[model samples]
Target: MAFHYPNGTPYNNHEAPKSKKQVKKQKSIQFGKRGMDFEEEINKSNAYYLSRNTAVIHKKPTPVQIVKVDYPSRSAAVIKEAYFRQASTTDYNGVYNGFYLDFEAKETKNKTSFPFKNFHQHQIDHIRQCLAQKGICFVLLWFSSLNRCFFFSGEALVTYWAEQETTGKKSLPLAIIEKNGIEIQIGIAPRIPYLDAVEQYIQSKKGVAMNDN
Candidate 1:
């Protein structure tokens, strides 16, 4: 089955094919040996949390409108084409420790910076709305090359996102993220142990300095 965007264009999870230079750059980056992709790691972590009654989190499912279906067999129906009902707002959202949690997960092979292109305007707007409601908002940024990840708050993201025009900076430097974001250590059962960062974030909001690590 082929999925399409609402604009009538084919829906592709990956960007267009990389150029020779891009491929060379990718080949040079040493990604973490961790068995799963960033998003998958997060999903497994969520499941772990759910099983332990630690927090309730899940990835928001993309709404698709099935266009054509064919019964290849009497018991099997195969969708031939579909279209997204609407663009996604953000990657994941849920309730954790009695506070609403919403975030996007992004990964980069670049060793020094994270490009602003990973975000879309709609996602920014959605985050802004969540902020208006005082909901907990942040992003999980995975630096594949360094095997590092950080919890970057939504407020900080908005601040840097706006500086694009004023400061002429297109990407968020790793130094800035390191300074402001909470670093999460990779683990086995919960591959991405992010709730620790979330707890720290909650503490910061209350003006209470505490580190559970």
Candidate 2:
């Protein structure tokens, strides 16, 4: 089975090179293979929000082009190869309290920083488009090792993303995230109760608007 990009180029998702310290720590904890699905938790949270009629968010589906398939006994089919229809933008998106919400979810084991290599150029371009339209765009970053999450606003993310080349920073530090993003506590009903953070973002936007006037 093989996968290709939309341009018919071979595609492979590879892990970024790790330092000796990271390798040593990884061997000790094996956190990479912990088998915890961060997106699954977000899906559960979305379900909870839907149940309460609070928001209508769904994970964005990636279109795949099936190249080869085998029909066995006319009962089932096996896909042999596929290609992505196009580069994806964001993860979850929907409407909440009359505001259009678009966001990405990410989980990292690094306690000190979130690697920028995890992101693609297409995603940043998409986020910029959404923000230009005044959309409520942000990212839900889960620090798996610490069991902590943060609501990293798209504006803040883009600012740092654009400065990467000049600043020579390969990752976004947790200290900066702590200063610009909203920390969210794990909860029961809505496991990642992110709307509260959205509310805060909205209020802050309003305050800025008022100040501008």
* RMSD vs true structure, all candidates: 8.3, 8.8
Model 1: number of backbone collisions: 0
Instruction: Tell me how far the alpha carbon of residue 167 in candidate 2 is from the true structure, in angstroms, after superposition.
Output: 1.9
Candidate 2's error at 114, in angstroms?
A: 1.2
TM-score for each of the candidates: 0.78, 0.79
Q: What is the C-alpha lDDT of each candidate?
A: 0.79, 0.79
Model 2: lDDT of residue 16 = 30
For residues 1-213, could you state the per-residue lDDT of candidate 2 as single tens digits?
222225553322122333435433332222333544566577878888888999999876555688999887687888889765654678679999999999988878898999887677778889999999999999988888888889999999899999995887899999999999999988887888999999999999999999999
* Clash-forming residue pairs, model 2: none
lDDT of candidate 2 at residue 182, scale 0 to 100: 99
Worst 10 residues of 2 by lDDT: 9-18
- After best superposition, candidate 1 residue 168: deviation in angstroms? 3.2
